[model samples]
Target: MSDTVEGPFFHGTKADLQVGDLLTAGFRSNYRPEIVMNHVYFTALRDGAGLAAELAPGDAAPRVYVVEPTGAFEDDPNVTDRKFPGNPTRSYRSREPLRVVGEVLDWTRLTPEALQGWRDRLAALRAEDRDEIIN
Candidate 1:
């Protein structure tokens, strides 16, 4: 059995995420409590589509936050993977079931600029992941 934890866990006030929803999270900085880094996320996907289609009865949706950090985001030790540069986009599964308190916007229906940003962010994340695996 593998002991590896697949994703970072986050705690929030409610579970309000659905697949394809773009979520923004404000991660508090460890160096400065007053500072918060905002990270966007495209909800968990299944077979290249939103995970919502994969849900079955009696199954509670997994609370996963896929980090989409921008170039401006500081590689804060407390908020992201220290091994990765800019801590590029990654999945952050919740440690315990917690409520979410953020906005969940559909990425497919968003304005052009926002959609482009999402695409760019995902591409960057894939590039970073590739580099990490290669090194």
Candidate 2:
């Protein structure tokens, strides 16, 4: 949403994304960070809980990264909307490849209120049958 980038940047903390979660991330090239991207969700191959430390150790652990048949939601926007570029609906996915920027959300834990709010959102995603990977 910042002027620096034209679209929204996905953000997830280390704790949010666990091993095997499905999610997407957008990466910005410019330090200023304003760009369009196509987001794709992948099955996390490794646990991201201590990703920073694992990467720092410099071993052949393959580190933290997602894997599997990558795909996107059919209805997901490939471009940023003028009104809410970074809003979840418009910005969650994009036309260009994005980096894994955040934790893959756990859809199963949706609270009643959260589920109610995102009912339409969940439908819009056109999620694949593989969503079961989260559980």
Pairs in clash, predicted candidate 1: 13-99, 14-99, 14-100, 15-99, 15-100
- 4-110 per-residue lDDT for model 2 (tens digits): 22322232222234444554446432111344333542222222222221222222432233333233332233333544354334223333343443333332233
Cα lDDT listed for each candidate: 0.35, 0.33
Cα lDDT tens digits for candidate 1, 20-82: 443344755222235564542222222212232122112353232333322232223433565
> What are the RMSDs of all candidates, in order?
15.2, 14.5
- The list of candidate 1 runs beyond 4 A from truth reads 1-94, 99-109
lDDT of 1 at 19: 37
Worst 10 residues of 2 by lDDT: 41-50
N/CA/C clash count, model 2: 10
